[model samples]
Target: MNTTTVITHQPVAPAPVVVKITERDWSTSLCGCFDDMASCMYGMACAPCFACKVSSKAGENCCAPCCVPGAMIAIRMKVRTRLHIRGSLCSDCIIDSCCGPCSACQLSREIDNSCNGHLM
Candidate 1:
């Protein structure tokens, strides 16, 4: 006499999906501060206040920039990372160090545009 065995195959769970984020340029350029006169004036009139505002808008503590040294660069990095904007820490440093007010205004505009669905 001979005996035979049967085997059955079961389906396995599918692999996890990986989303590839395509880095893009900032919604507004660093020097595009003047494009939004309101923000530009606000930033120029009171840079610290503007920085704090942008910091808060970016989801960081409002006072972080005022209390922490080089916090703007960190804020820029955070915003850049959050928005998947293509930029480097060195460039952020240069922008913030050269014209802090302008950087703040740009960040503000970027945040505004992001919130307004202007960025894809």
Candidate 2:
């Protein structure tokens, strides 16, 4: 007669660890064109030089077209959202130094850079 023994073994491979990237809320304000507006609003005074304007009756902010050729209209507005990357790591700092027309564009560039071009 022969005796047999049974043994149990654990799995050879270990589970992989998943790292989740945290998102943080960030906000920025800029001034530019409103995208859609009738000419009757501003009339002759509407030079499109300063897109940012205050509605005389509504008391709200408004935007207009740009005066310079090839230069898009720039308006002032607030941009708020959650970013996947941290502020310090953003590339806006680099772009701001190189080519930035306004503080808002510079900040957006920095955010885009920090997010590795993933900023929306």
Leading candidate by lDDT: 1
Native-referenced Cα lDDT, model 1: 0.87
lDDT of 1 at 93: 96
For residues 5-87, write the lDDT of model 2, one tens digit per residue.
77788657977989987755333322221221232234324433223322111122333223332222121121222444234
Q: Write the per-residue lDDT of candidate 1 for residues 4-114, one digit (tens) a residue.
A: 977687779999999999999988888896679988988999999988888888888889999999999998888888899998999999999999999988888988888
Candidate 2 matches the true fold with a TM-score of 0.23
Candidate 2 residue runs with Cα over 4 Å from true position: 1-11, 27-109, 112-120
Tell me how candidate 2 scores on lDDT: 0.33
For every candidate, C-alpha RMSD to the true structure in Å: 4.7, 14.8
Off by over 4 Å in 1: 1-16, 117-120
TM-score of each: 0.81, 0.23
